[model samples]
Target: MKKLLILILLLPLLFVGRQVYSDDCDTSSVSNLNESQVKEMIGKCQKNWEMIVNAKKPHEESLRQMEKQLAAFQARLNTIASDLKQKEIKINEGDALLGKQEEILAHRVRQFYIKSFYNTPLLLIFSENKSNVEDVVRVLAYQQATTNDDKKTIIKIALYIKNLEDKKKQLETEKNQLSSLQTNVSEQAGKVKKLLTEANAYQVKLEGQISQLSARQEQLLAEKYAGSNYPMSVGETEPSRPVDDRTIDPGFRPAFDFFTFGYPHRVGMSQFGAFGRAKAGQNAETILKAYYNNVRIEKRDNLMGNINVNGYGSKSFEDEYLKGIGEVPSIWAEKGGYEALKVQAIAARSYAVSYTNNGQGSICTTQECQVYIGHNKGGDWERAVNDTRGVVIVSNDTNEVIKAWYASTAGGYTRTSADVWGRSTPFTKRLADLDGAGKAYEGPSYGDSPWFYVAWGSRSEYGNSAWLKSEEVADITNALMLYKADGGTLIHLSQPDKSNGDTWSSDRVKEELRNRGKNPYNSVSDVDTSSWRNGNGITSTVIIHGDAGDNTFDGGDYKYVFNIRAPANVHLKTALYNVEKK
Candidate 1:
């Protein structure tokens, strides 16, 4: 019997040993992960860092070139302006010279006309006739000859004057053309100078950003050592926002609160669960590649809400929508209608909330909160987030989500502002040699110093909430007003409900809703709404310890207790159980 006892004791010790050994990690899968993996990962991260820093390299060089070109262009412009001024003066002098030439031409033409009219006529009259004729006939012939000679001289002089005027007009046209060319060149030079000035300013801004990134990278590296090992878990609780059984009128559609429970952005599939656990220094790209050929573009609809919608006439719930029921009219409970929000509340209570603190935080616009400013690819995610401007309703009975009333974060209204950090301490991203603890002093490997430290900076691992835009408040308030317009109970999850940490509840939440203009309401019991109790007050849900079934109460372990299987992509860390056994 003593030997039997020793064996029994040894069995427990063996089990414990196995558990401890499991903690050492499974290195067999990564046989080649000596120091090589670490170097490769760090190298990739460093490269990405460099790309961001060097985004301005070309611009900086362009700015320098611009400065050089600008100065040269300016000098050329100045010289052109001076030469243009001198040319303009010379043009004026040429005009004066041309005017003098025109005057001389006019005087010569006048003299020729005058000489032709007087001397030529007289010469012709005298030479021609007195000897040639009968008195009347001879006189007439001489007169005609004289007249012809005079007309010929006048015609010649007029032609000469016309040629001189044509020459003068051509000279004026050439001068105007030269002035226009000078003006165009001057305009182009001015444009280049303006562009150069803007480019220099842009380069300076980019340099500042590079400095900030360098400092921030160092801070990130420092936080690597302080990382947490455990994943976050959700606690058990009765649904705070319970569905009403009597409240099930026809044509009810339970509006699922989207912002809080909508599927979270997926992290890349991990060969190891978390990024830190993967090969150190390896970036997400390399690690992801090594595990799978490449990151597959998985359809997001593959991960739908985790709930059994049998009342809606479907055996299983698919992606956030109801099939077959769409054909049914609003009057039918089986089709276009939902079980009063109360009946649906029970199934949801069995469902778990997300691992993060569901949208409760100090929302802000500063880099502290990493507000999604509608500019990048990630901007699309902003549409679905609640920016802390509205209210959310939960069932008092089970604490499952009932509704999330969101405000528009469109305008300039703000609810709050704060930063989320990766570490408690601040550091720079220096490329220096790291100590045993990976602490940095300084070097090429080291980046510039950071401005601030955020405790929960990485949403990839730690998870994140949204920043409420000031503009969203009225829309959020109006939506909440609609829920309050009818009758709805508001349950707050952040406030502690019971003495133990097992649950969280708040009367203040209901009051807040009422203040927001919701109708007056009363609290109901979870036992009446949930499968918490049978006829004898003997519980059917989980019981962990001794008699009254109160030790650690959880729902049953029956896989399909609610006549449903767990949904795909559902994350259940804490097991639920039935309290049937002692």
Candidate 2:
């Protein structure tokens, strides 16, 4: 019985030990693992990552509460300090008054003694003047009465001084105790913050491990299924055409088309929007000012120095580094987009200077930073670079060079750094890329970006079909329902066609949906989309009418499920999207 009790007590500890061991994702052995083993590892890592993420919130809240408490304690300590200073002043004033009173009492005593020595009662009685004797007696009685009052005043003042000293001592003791408490609370807050930071670092480590494992899994799958057409994920600048519903025969009378607003992260200056604005007769300054709010174009001639470019070491900042930038098409400069090219040059220059911290650091030659193609791009690009000489975008508030983040397209709206990356910057603003009439100029007549309002899919893998069938659409809704009902492995909800392994079959998904008290649909009859603009624009709500019933989903949730469950060939690239029913 004792053994049984001991085992019961140890059960929780054993379980915790196993959990900790599982959470330690050692990717060093991933290379030797099979496809199934890698996928299983990914699942475990993802689960652990979620657990860490959820656990971070409480610690963060506790830290915030402790900080508030610390502030309150500081304010209270200040008040007590101020009170002590005032009490000390009063005590000094009382001491000075008591000294003055003591001097007056001593002088009065000397006067009384002198009068008694000179006008003795024996001489008054021997003299023949009775009135003189009575006057002397009255004067002596008055002097004695005044002396008694002075003694009472001295005693009262002494008692008051003693009380003040006692109160001051009490305040000092209280102050010391409070200071100690504040220190302990501050230490606790520091500990909480450290734990939160460690958790964040652990989360990053887990994510890295998962990324490595996923890469291995992808490699293993690619090796296993050689010669099979596996669709590639969409790139930022992949040339794509808009889905024309009139041409696509989806093998059904009624079909739906999903149109995405933007291609990539919709933050900072829109390159295509800049081109469009420049074409609209706006100068380079105006184009830049429109994208980045409250900024000034400043010329910093002193920034002329050498910048270390990876692979191509130590290039001239003004001439060599700026010329090698191949961000925009050089041909655009010749075709009435010279202002846009100049904007790109200035933006690129500013980004380089800020990123390198005035030539103290090194920048890479990839889109991860700014694309730096070695050697001068020459032609109009060279002219654009020279035109913007030493000009860079500076934040008016900070008076420092802005990062000048620019993307290929922002669809129509741009988001702040805080909205996208959880870090706020002073210069970036969320603004609509609209014209005088408050309409986006990134459509057919303006920016003319192919990624604008296009269905996402790699054409090579889908047999040139980017459109979804009715049943496939229904499967997406089913996946979303199951996800909302029971939070499980996200990849399990992925479409069977694109899933490498460990995905729920269509039948199993529908069964799970039904088990969770959700109505699973066979085919989507009709779909409706609603959108409202915010930091992350459009596609706010979606309502789907299926054979089983109608279901409504939040747009962001729908986008998440769509990206996960949709085929690799076709996925929603951004959250801002619309659905059309025909």
Candidate 3:
């Protein structure tokens, strides 16, 4: 019995020992793997960062060389244009001069013919037959004068005609030569333009790379010194742990956010397959200035709220902006992407879009459709993303919400001079809160604007065509409830009507929304829209007024008011309550 008891105790001890040993081995393996991964990431990041840095120096030098070449070429082209203009003018003058010479030659030739053939021999014969010698001599003198005049006229006409014809031929030859030279110079200009375009594109790419490297450098410095300050909790998946200095690891590899949240430089159609725009030889300073300036503008306009404006200087922004604008659009168009812009808007539009169209989780933080994991310390690449907000709208299939969009922050509205032909939608208008303070719905519920009085049910015409709060709810119930009581519009704006009515039909409204394709819920909302969305996490709501005909509202006699969500107003609201658990 004593031995049995002892054996039991010993067996338990043996099991415990084995468990500890196994745990230690597993830990060792895990640590070793983590250390190796960190080291590998660090090496790759460093290589890429260094390569970008080295690339910039050469890129800048190449750009300077290209700029000089471009300047010379442009100057030569300008000279050619000027010379051609002058040559054309001279040709015109030459033609006029030739005409005058021809006229003079013709007159001289006619006079010569009359004197030489008809008068000269007759006068000579008459002089020989004269009775008085002195009189005969006088007659001979007259005849001699006529003959000499005729000979002189003939010689002058021949020389004049020959000289005029020669001059005309010479002018024609000179004109051809000038035109050929002009053509050659123009062709060279086109090539220089292409070069400038390539340089500009290369420069942009280099700068972006440099910005990324600098961000990485900053991240490394931060990691080496101060560890990431954000906290992690239990149940958190893939927690961001502090960097282990003992082990070398590259920080998180920055992801490519495919969403185009910010406005990038416009690229022309032809530049799609061309070489890098900055590679063509645009100056680094100019390209940098443009990128930063645009970043600044976007930041101010609430488009690129995530960009770090403090890192760049005004001069840099100006230089880059000019260079980018001056460059050919083809290169950037082909290679440029919206990754930077999407990252920037993450801060501006947090939790706006769920992670995926497919319902994997309740929410998504991935950069795909959700907010970007912006500028956390210990991450690589730090410059502000280029402006991309407000340029495009993010919408769902139903067109209920503008899930997200891009906009430009630059001033001097596009409608002014150069961008006159551009899209006329104003950033302020797009970004403004025009409906704030109940601007359109200030009147009493009964008298709210005639355009959208349908909410009150008083023979209102406006509410018939719009997407009601709920299809099941009658207009008298939901539509009127939204009126004077809440002072909110029941109807929303649709594409301008083809007919004379203020609102489109329900079908027409849906079709218009689909065609317009704006994500109405994308704007800052008081409450989340995902809760009410269908399985796809997308919903569209339309606010419209009455149709054109009066069958429903007495044939247009009842003018219904159009209720729209004020740009400044929040579409939804949220509240949180805390409870104590004992």
Candidate 4:
């Protein structure tokens, strides 16, 4: 199988036909750029892809927020529904009481007017005139109630009936108002869903583009390292999958490889659960314990001092290093509102230790490692750093500094490193990182950074899907075909488990065509939307479309079943996305 995969990867070189180059990334047309320049362009494109992928964090948060609001509105509507029913009952009772009171008080015609209101004579209507007046007197005479006081008593009853009618009207008005509020809430909720869906669609589009770009790079890489051993095995995990879910989404379609979940991640997943646990009276240790795996906090001597980060000479003291971490805002621990700052401090310190490039003695001050600013004294950073002095994260199994990678926030379900990085370590496990209210951080549209640490300066993961340009799929498809023609792997993909399935590392649709013994994707006729899965998470829909006029097999009515699973770095954001015809 491995031998077959290696041969399959080289299939592209056998058919170096006339290349139909992509307008965007036309590598074949360019000779001005040397190898370095090509690498530079690839790097820049990869960076852009990363940015696009991370862009989903805010939209996800927004959608999450809207969902929460929707839920609240639903709850309120339920309450209003109950109250409206009660109001109807009360109004009916009031109507019946008013009728009875008006009937009983008919004898006091003139007095009723004086008691209920002085000016509103129109509101007080009489059923009978002079003939009724005689009857009224007769009735009163029979009861021996001809006195003026008796007339006032009957008038009071009439006034009481008027008040009942007034109350019934007020209740009805309230019911109408509540009903209006319900309608508005429902509308807003609908709008939120629309916005969320659009945001999610945008995420999908971005992933698709990234997937295209990544596939371009992957093919280039395959061609670059076909004979040499570079770990593009038939079963190796995609390097960017689980670890880069924070960004670098590969349009991971489940249908691409029998609809399976690909490499997953805990890198960009949420810590809201841990925050929630802490807020709910769980101690910092407990919170950390839940999120971290097989880890023990150990007091250690300051790591080697004066590390070089980026271009600047970074001071090496553990506390000073903690002080310099610019990734998290300084105000977190100083404000004392969010104890998560301390946890961050410890994680930052541990990360610094892990990133200490033994060769260069330098770490990147950028997101490539963790952001670092020299001696940030803002907020209680000093205090927080001091309190957690000599603390370093150690893997219980390895007894070394663990890769204490953390992001601004996890969506909710902290991914396992195994899922994200394609290789799980004992310490890189998934945690029920929840919110203080015990809700999953990634649960719904609770978009606002409910975690206090994020409110200040921490960047949260954003977006649903990156938007794909109309021609990108075609361009990418064309590129993949070219790559295949150039003796690169064009058919069959390496599964996460080293198993083989029909998929190009870059273009699944093309792989599907090849599986049927056809030419690589010459053109994307249309993207099927019927198998669409709407979004809250990454995996969305199944795609069924017909692609005809290929090199080997010209056919139609092909159905792609996406594994409704979210493995990482594969390009199926939704089951089926839009396709551009060339």
Candidate 5:
């Protein structure tokens, strides 16, 4: 937060950095001025304060969100910790039961051994029966008492002990799970608690700054306005409606798709790259340039509109929208700390701004827009948001805000906006990524090259052990058939005519393929795997022969190829994939 506390960028003037307001305003109150000047000054102060307050709205909401999440996590942690204790107790009890059963079994075995060994005929004869009557009688009695029932009792005790041991092992495993869950929940709560304290302190600092300026605001406004005559327009930019404004969807960029979809920055695992650089002592801006192409970090003007916050129509800042977003994994912010999260905050801010082009809908709460579930106020995320407040990534080409689309995975190359969205965006075209050799499977983080080949199935998430089987060929065939489906059916959905250059997975493929009556692929040999970007690995294109015949389907440029879907359990991993025999 020291980054935010430092007013280096915010010092020279009021309202915005590097921007002269429609009218220049004094940074301090009580700077002597004329009557007209005073009025303008007061107006400026009030307006700037309003904007600042508006900006603070999101941060406040973010804090609220964080509090809620922390509370929930705390509750969860408590439950898990309690369960862990219970499981431990159960295991201990089971141990005690097994030990007692073991003792009883040992005692029974000793009794049976004594009864049979000492009473043997040879031993009895050598001892002279009457002389050793006491020992003989003891042995004879034990031997007589050893019945079929005694043997069954020993067997039963052993089995009972075995069952107790198994139960104990099961309880131990459960205890471990509870312990892990507790750790996760506790970490979130602890971090959130620390952050909340920092956030409150920062807020207090801001309040003090605003209060000092407000105290002398009236006198300064009066003096400035009395001296000059400057016309002021109260309503230059009309307040816009959300529905009318351009809608922006700031959501999770899927694993491969984040990098593959057009955004100038490092698409997937861009955070990892940022973290690596940040830890290496590179500043935030240096890290930003590495992933995003043609990046310009600009101090954004205050333009946040009212948000349908938490279902109530509340006026909040744009940063709130970013902080509220749950689509982003907390791990990046937690592991990488400020630097890594700073990059995320910028990307998210830019992505949100691009969507806020219009005064559109109640804040989009789903990944359909960008998942905004909200967060606890004081955390690394809040720090990241505050550090780079109002800053956005702009494309140098058009000098416009770039539509920052990102995902979790990208084949070796980022997708061309034209191919994916059918738009001719210069900046978001297919670009090369640094995919290593073993890129087919998922890794610990997003920066790694994931399998783009639909056939190279590794549902690393599910268990990292699934592959495309021959039976799934039908699904792959169907995805390809969707492209071949009479051409006009789903093409309109893509709007080839409209090109703003945004590319993510086209759900239109799935939607179009739906309700189409198709038969399952009966054979793998009958399917074609010849057309490939990389034969044994990930590729941008792959041809799946819907039919064993020579007839070809019309593919845009790659020519008739099977379009594999990414959903692993249901669809193939990518377009380029081969089916393994079941």
Candidate 6:
């Protein structure tokens, strides 16, 4: 029993000692793993988790059984103890009765001895009468019979006391055995509990490893399908065009349509909106003033003669640099987009002057700065540049050149600098980009940009359809629920990679939702925008109806979680986007 107790006390220590020497699940190396390595590691981690769970089950059952056995042993030991106590009380009573009976028998034997030694010998010695002698013999016989009966009664009482003592001793022996058995069972239970604890800790460790592997996988996939992969610049010289989702047929019914209001950053001028305005007989100055609030078109002569251009050394700011900027299509000039070209020219020139701080800094030659091709883009583009010679957009409040940030499209509304970058600028304003009567000109007669409103995805890669399936949409909703619950650890909840065997199954996501105390949906039945940013055209609140129920979420959060958890090629281009269920 002592040895068993000592072993129980040492069980946890032994387990700990073994764990200290054993190989642990080291997730620190996850960052160094490539996609293939990460997938392999995830598989191994999952297998390890299964092994730990399997190992823990038997120990848990054994612990339960041991607990029940210990309870039974305790009850039996109590019963034995009670029996022994009652037998002891009876044995004590029997001992007192036997003592009294023995004393009484001794006194009676002494009185009979005195009477027989005196009276009976005198009757025999006198010999006067036979009857007298006969009477003395009868009295002696009766006394002997009475003494025998007393002696027999005392013997029976003593025998009964002995039987009670014997029974009490047997019960005590049984109680000792049960107590030892109970201690053994308790010790076994302790050992099993320790084993179970160790198993649980190992399971947690494996789970952590799996999470790290998944996060690394997600990072790799995100890098593969970065937003930079999309074309942010627009011009005839730009190589790629945005994929129009309308041209493709979504093979599945009840599609979840992700309608984006704009293509890129909606911070400044909308290039297509300018085209539409120019088509509607608006001049370059009018279009620029409409987008840039409180800004004037002014020709500045104090500008530097030469500005440093990245990868091409210094160049003339007006004569050489302005001619090569290819922001809008030259073909638009033939199609009544001349005023828009002039607007682009002036905006590009003003942006360069402010960006360089009057030639103090160098600028890159990408859309990140401005798309600049080396030679003069002789054509309508050159004509527009020359027509707006030395002209720059200057802020009225600051009396300085404005940055004049612009993008390809703005859906229907433009965002302010404060809305986009969290820093307010005097020149930038959130405008509806509509006509005088609150009518937009972006559909057929004007800008006609393909990206005005469309679903986003890699159509060439994923079945020529930019629309999402019902289950896929539900998965995105689940991702949002998890993000709302615990956004920190759910970084890897991206769409599963089937090729690499690192898929986060739909059932798995549902299980996680249940574990986090959030409802999971099987399919998204409908989705609609609940609120919009007043005058900004950005969706604010969205309500998603699923099989589980309807849930409301912040628009920005929905966009963020959707981008991260959606398929690699599919993503919302901006936060100011909407979702439609078809």
lDDT of each: 0.27, 0.75, 0.28, 0.45, 0.45, 0.77
User: How many clashing pairs per prediction, in order?
Assistant: 61, 0, 78, 85, 59, 0
**Candidate 3 lDDT (Cα, whole model)?**
0.28
Candidate 1 regions with alpha-carbon error over 4 angstroms: 1-97, 110-114, 117-120, 128-494, 497-582
Model 6: residues >4 Å from true position, as ranges? 1-230, 237-244, 459-462, 498-504, 530-535
Flag the better candidate by lDDT, 2 or 5: 2
lDDT over C-alpha atoms for residue 139 of model 5: 60
| Cα RMSDs, all models | 30.3, 9.4, 32.7, 25.5, 31.3, 25.8
For model 2, the stretches where C-alpha displacement exceeds 4 angstroms are 1-119, 128-259, 292-308, 314-319, 349-361, 378-404, 413-432, 436-439, 456-536, 540-568, 577-582
For each candidate, what TM-score against the reference? Answer: 0.21, 0.66, 0.24, 0.38, 0.38, 0.60
Worst 10 contiguous positions by lDDT, candidate 3 = 573-582
Q: Output the TM-score of candidate 3.
A: 0.24
C-alpha positional error of residue 467 in candidate 6 after TM-score superposition, expressed in Å: 1.6
Mind giving the per-residue lDDT tens digits that candidate 5 earns over 332-351?
45444357567667766676
Task: Name the lDDT of candidate 4.
Answer: 0.45
Give a tens-digit lDDT track for model 6, residues 24-128: 456788888765457556756766676666566666766776677677777777788788888888988888898899898999899899988877676687888
Candidate 1 structure lDDT:
0.27
> After TM-score superposition, what is the CA distance of residue 257 in candidate 6 from its true location, in Å?
2.1
**Candidate 4 on 430-539: residue-level lDDT in tens?**
55444556555323333223221110111122223222322333434443344334423322322222223433344554565466565654344444432222322222
Candidate 5 residues lying further than 4 Å off, grouped into runs, are 1-292, 303-312, 358-362, 375-377, 435-522, 526-569, 573-582
User: What is the TM-score (0 to 1) of candidate 6?
Assistant: 0.60
Q: For model 6, what is the error of residue 472's alpha carbon versus the real structure, in angstroms, after optimal superposition?
A: 1.0
Candidate 4's C-alpha runs over 4 A off are 1-265, 268-281, 302-310, 314-316, 331-337, 357-360, 432-438, 442-582
| Top-lDDT candidate index | 6
